[model samples]
Target: MPSSLARCVLSCALSAAALAIPVMSAQSAAAEVVPMPPHEKTFASPDGPTFVVGSEGESINKVPPLNASGTVREVFISGSSYTRSDAPSGGTLAVGYHVGCAVELQGGNVGVGPNAYLNPGLLDQEDIGPVVSINVGPGSVSDVPLLTKEVVSGVPARIMMRDIHLVVNGCIGPAVVRQYTLMQLHTDSLDDIGVVYGDPLWI
Candidate 1:
């Protein structure tokens, strides 16, 4: 019933509207399906140990024992601290960064010690539990200590580390003080060191 020009215009308008509907729907669907980034999602999920700041200002973390057949190939730690001393002779204080773990050996399951695991004395078949009391340098986080041999391996073991600060008093001057922060650890078995430090990506 419409004239030729009017009919042509109407048909074009209907076709344009039909095309726009699909585009709009697709856009809406995309918006609704927005996904979080991989790293963010991984951090949001609880797949490993949880760290909490202790009353003494140390970063304390507890991890479940490794699986039955799992083994730890390496251990590493890094951190930073600030030291102030008023004495004429600079006094040295040893701060312990503790890491405790269960070690499976020929005899039986035993707890790891500073000189026992990750050192030169023994080779643990499987390292489990928590390893603690590793010492870190003062005022810098750039140093990372990695241990390849004499570490626990092969069986299930829990792992734990505590951050610590040691301050030595200067005999001749004011008070000596040391503060440690931003401590972190890593191992071949666990790539996400941030989990040990309590921050997902190291704050």
Candidate 2:
């Protein structure tokens, strides 16, 4: 990625975080830190299976909030992200509008809400996709079931799916998703948000 575009992605990420920060307050804080579970990482993508993990101090969130009805653990490794563009200047302009959608979970029982106000901002470009992937490892996919999801075909967000609820099976608990909405705030036909599992043990 070009330096300028990279900067824009970073900026958008910040904006999303800023917008989502308020939702943190909605999360109920709890005492006691849950011990991080011992985990192993492996991949099943056609690229080939690889593994990585070391016993350390990665504290396990006894509880966690849901992102758009999905598991927050999706970022147990790669962290979070926001909108980005292919053009250098376009990235900047697009990112400016994506403020405050960052992945922020306060402990294990908190999270950001969908349609959660985005600090109110504007930009020149409304086209850009949020970067998504597990560039790193040692995290587990949330057991939260995918209730309903559909992709926007022929569009950059085609990679970014939306409106996946976790309770259609009525098996989901608040521990998974209390209330959430997954909407495409912005996109650029790249870096679509996709889902994957890490290990069977985690399943």
In terms of lDDT, which candidate is strongest?
1
Estimate the Cα RMSD of every predicted model relative to the unseen true structure.
23.3, 21.9
Candidate 1: TM-score?
A: 0.21
lDDT tens per residue, model 1, 16-129: 999999977764443221111111111211334322211122232212112311222122222322122222222211122222223111111123543453432122323533
- lDDT, each prediction: 0.27, 0.25
What lDDT score is found at residue 174 in candidate 1? 19
Candidate 2 wrongly placed segments (more than 4 Å): 1-30, 44-57, 60-203
- Regions more than 4 Å wrong, model 1: 32-50, 53-203
Compose the digit string of candidate 2's lDDT tens values, residues 27-128: 434212333333332222232222221122222223233434433332222111122222211111111010011222211211124332122122111223
Candidate 2's displacement at residue 136, Å, is 30
Among all candidates shown, the one with the greatest TM-score? 1
